[model samples]
Target: MPNRQAGISFCDGPKEREGREGRPAVNLRTLKYFVAIADAGSLTAAAEAIAIAQPALSRQMHALEEEMGVPLLQRTARGVRLTQAGVTLYEAAQRMLDEAQRVKRQLAGPSEAGESRVVLGVSPTLSRVLVPGLFERCHRTMDQMRLTVREAFTPELLDMLEKGMVDMAIITSMGASADRPLALHPLVGEPFALATPRSMKMDPIISLAALSRIPLLMTTLHRTVVERQLRPMGVHLNIHSEIDSVDAIRELVHDGDWCTLMPVSVFKEARSDAGITLTEVSGVQLNRQLMMATRIEAVPSTAVAALREIVLAELARLNRLRVFNFGKKPVKR
Candidate 1:
């Protein structure tokens, strides 16, 4: 038997508890209120996020506290804090709420309409090149399907796909093993280029050998390529600084003060945006394979098919555009 003194009861809600009559329909709202109170460190901020009035949020919190027979939130002059009991339950409430929303979306979507929702991931590296245009094209092609996209690093996206968070991912990867459990569709190869600021106003590109004395901005790729390519050419670079972001490296290059060797996909956009130029080093070319990777197709959801088609179409369009000169002789892997 349950302890009556602990406030435990099967019918947890407002109004009549002994009978369903006059009882307000209660569910996870109480758990959500407890979460809000804990995060806001007070009732107000949490209430705002939850779109409930502060006092109402407080009331929900109080009801939840009473149901648990434990004070979930502690009030002090500074505001509110979660009690030890509240902290433990809040973590569980979060996962429950997320799964509930996931189920709700599945139920609300039409089952017979052949319209399904697909969630996919794109690496930030590719987002810069494809995002705006991809959105326009997907709408025209898959009007019935609801498409969703998320951006993260390749490793992060891979984790999401493995964890069933996303259906597929478009990314740049180097030699993902064949034994790995994934389906990879080959896309155009992303090549490398040596970009320099347009402000230099240099003549029609000369051999990379001639520009060896120039100060190239060091990016991660330089270590991968230039150390091998440049040393042999007798080029002595006064590398300006080691930076990470393609955008930042572009700024340094576009300013006419620095140069860097980078993959052409990144170089392509940075060149257009920052008014920079990339020339094949006249000796070395490096390209990373770009592709769409997915787990084995699920129960044939239309949304999944639509998303896969759109992604494939995008890859096709890029290939047709010949934007990266993938036709250039393949570099030795």
Candidate 2:
């Protein structure tokens, strides 16, 4: 019998080693060895990186090349080099190795892990309220969650979620929809509030165009702010500036002579400044149902469920505080 290889036992598949297939039977271990060799440009260096013996690695590499049914490396006196075929195969093999590693990591992490890596999209509108509280709760509950957060408008976030690029997203209330492979779970209901400087005397129920000259600090979602707060009186308001930061809006309203229509959450933030008041909208009342959304088939990790529970608990606590007046400077737009 031909001299059997020592490291040949490492190969997982057994069809007489590529028997009848005419191709070398390859496995994950071989792919990793191949990538390491290509990267280091030498078997000795690759073996050092992977903590395997050079001779053992060489045997496996030789077995892999045989399975491939083609000469892969150009082993010249200078060093080992890959032929064109090896280069092409290495590129594809590298991707497979990377994907396999990701799978392994995903599995090893939290079987019921909230720590599973996820790319999450957040709406700027909801971020104004949920960001701080969410972070606090994430730290407290979902210790394993590795979150990559991106802030965008509702339309953009929803688009990313629909594209299956993001794991899940938190978007503003755009009405209920089960058509887009998205399942919405309503969390909080945000009512429109007038965020304005305290010095300005605002009517309990005011119509638009009353302050046609006043500057409007608005986000991209300003339309919802307007239609809900001012459209009842047929007020066609001119938006002076469309901005992103609710904090900046509060600052402009506090320092300069600007007023904006915002949500109750911004009102919560502005309470500290003593210069802004978040007043109930009297003209047209609208509430956005803030929701947590994920793919219809997604199973929430234990960490995600725990985090959600913490958020809901916080929301419940805040709901109770809504009744008690915390005498702070008020900002009502």
Candidate 3:
């Protein structure tokens, strides 16, 4: 009978026991599960992300720990934390999995002869300004490449990138964590502006003090960035609502008295709209850095690099057109 451990069966034949020159056999699938668990910080989340049952994932992990003869995970009240051994294994497995993907891609060849696909992720606000130009440029210049665009919030984009669902993402500096396995390329600096209906009769610029008193609606991500910088200075925002949807916020801002703070590029195209006006906020540095984020482990293929350059070129075109007063000195009271 095959030796079984925690619902996992392993062949007990002489060669299987010896496991390729007296070393324990390593299952690439189990290693992938371990990596997913490490990335997600919990077995439940990892299972959900990969669409496996939690009990089965747990059994696999348990069998892996038993086979390795070392504790890999430490269960905590909040979730699971990797032990020292787990950390070492996680890092190595990450590299191995990345290499395996590279080898697989090499074997499968490009989607077409001399052609490959690259998936890019961007936020809703940035998408409005970047996507149309990006698509146009890719069509004209990157004829051998296929491009797919995904729109989501910063955290969601990060998740997608980590899962290899996106080859690259246009992420804000606020969301790029120092510890993530990502390589960041600076794209542009975007400044936040106070958006209001033109009927509000507000100044072209408002001080931070006055800005704090007004009720505002903001996305959760934007609010976090704002508060992290302002709360320590004794200034607090009177947030009327925290709506994550950009369209919803725009509709509410344009049809009502509530104003919202967001990157200038978000509404740059709507400058000619008679219903709303974008006011610069004074006495605060609301400059947001935009970055091109890619996985540190995966080497960029030729198509990926070409797509990246096209994105940069499109951004340069937007900058030349003054899409959003980028790099300008902040307004003063």
Per-prediction TM-score: 0.60, 0.56, 0.66
Question: Using TM-score as the measure, what is the rank order of every candidate, best first?
Answer: 3, 1, 2
lDDT of 1 by residue, 32-137 (tens): 6677777778887888888878887777666666556576677999988777977887877765665566667777877577666777788765776676667788
Residue-by-residue lDDT tens digits, candidate 3, 1-333: 123333323342323233543445656777888999999999899999989999999987886787776789999988899999899989878666765665577578887567787889998889988999999999998888878888988787887788776789999988888788888898888788888888888888899999999999999999999898887788999999999998788878878567999887777664425676778888778878899999886567787788888888999988876766734323345
The local distance difference test score of model 3 is 0.81
The candidate 3 region of ten consecutive residues with least summed lDDT is 7-16
Q: Rank the candidates by lDDT, best first.
A: 3, 2, 1
Which should have the higher lDDT, number 2 or number 3? 3
TM-score of model number 2? 0.56
User: Which candidate should be chosen as best, given TM-score against the real structure?
Assistant: 3
Clashes of 1: 0
- lDDT for each residue of candidate 2 in 55-128, tens digit (9 for 90 to 100): 98888878777666577898988669999979997977865664565556666875564346665677765565
1 versus 2: better TM-score goes to: 1
Best by lDDT: 3
